[model samples]
Target: MQPSEGSRIVVGVDGSPSSHAALRWADRYARGVGGAVEAVSVWDTPSSRGWSGPAIDPDFDLGQARELFERELHEVFPDGLPDGLTRHLVEGDPSEVLIRASEGAEMLVVGRRGRGGFARAVLGSVSQRCAQHAACPVVVIRQQDDPAR
Candidate 1:
């Protein structure tokens, strides 16, 4: 679909380096198309179900986490951002939210793998799902390789 003035470029952010790259790429594309940018972060608190694992604290403090997410977005958005820029912190699955938001967007962007180690070539669940099901075109941003690493 052709990008219009009200068209949106949706991006999924997890506050990771790869996610940040996706946000930057989305920002540039949105600017070039004279469209809006939506930076969405999905936060789903784990439930204390009948599962055996590490002891989970039901009352984990998420205030700091939200603050960090906002701060990181600001940092990624250098040279200032457009007024159309929006940050959404929804409580749901990342892939679901991304697909729903992309219904009306011109395009969607996400990281190949977010905050996870996939020694070889493997796409993260969220990115993979988005790519397979999103209504709009999707771009998978790869994390930059550090020469020092």
Candidate 2:
């Protein structure tokens, strides 16, 4: 009476409105299909802020990324994650990160546009890249009514 590992739906979350919408949609879809949803957020130290000294610098807090990811999860699910839902915090490019996370997943869900605005006019870079490279089907959720359409 439980979904197999292959039925897992991997969603890319970046704390953006669109990404939040994708998470909600994934939750609904997973419920309908009796599957599980795993929320994934990717973060990396900017090149501009790369290591300037030893990896263990008291001045630097490595937990920042995990904190951010948890904060986003809370924002999306203030009531807490659905029963059996999972979460992950990774470090890497969004596209590469989501693509890798989708391995063996039944589906990959993403928002139409993330934090990047005009830069992702057609399709958000991460969504586009995942659609092109993901091993499973990709579902792009619209965050808002596109008045232009």
Candidate 3:
């Protein structure tokens, strides 16, 4: 059966290995359920977060974020993006952006951890927040340890 128009799966992508895994899982799940996929990538300037760090160009950061978002999508869908896949590159907090995107979605998918500084965390802050506050059900995908790594 073909997915109805309301069947949308929102997934967060942050250029992390776990995020890639989440994207893959979201796509597969969407296909199985006849749903569409919406991939969201978020970026924020240090000043926006009130960080007292050295001045940085916001344009440059946005560009890098866009690049990473595109790269991640290409890496995941090397052959081509699926028919119902949509991409969004927004500038804001990752958690807030993803949560907002989750509205009206069938489900929200995210990586257990992202490209954050905390290495030992079982769940990244963004994913944790989304799981807690998103309007839709959330699925967190854990990154598999590669034997080669």
Best by the TM-score measure: 3
Best by lDDT: 3
> Model 3: how far is 134 from its true place, Å?
1.0
TM-score, one value per model: 0.79, 0.79, 0.85
* Candidate 2 positional error at 136, Å: 0.3
- Candidate 3 clash pair list: none
Against the unseen true structure, what C-alpha lDDT does each candidate score? 0.78, 0.80, 0.85
Candidate order by lDDT, decreasing, is 3, 2, 1
Candidate 2: which stretches are off by over 4 Å?
Answer: 1-6, 48-62, 117-124, 145-149
Write the residue-wise lDDT of candidate 3 on 79-138 in tens digits. 998888999999987888999999988899998878777542545588888989999899
Q: Estimate the lDDT of model 3.
A: 0.85
lDDT of 2 by residue, 97-136 (tens): 9999999898999988787556455555889889999998
Instruction: Report the error of model 1 at residue 58, Å.
Output: 6.9
Task: Report the C-alpha lDDT of model 1 over 30-56, residue by residue, as the tens digit.
Answer: 888888889998765455324534565
Q: How many clashes in each candidate?
A: 0, 0, 0
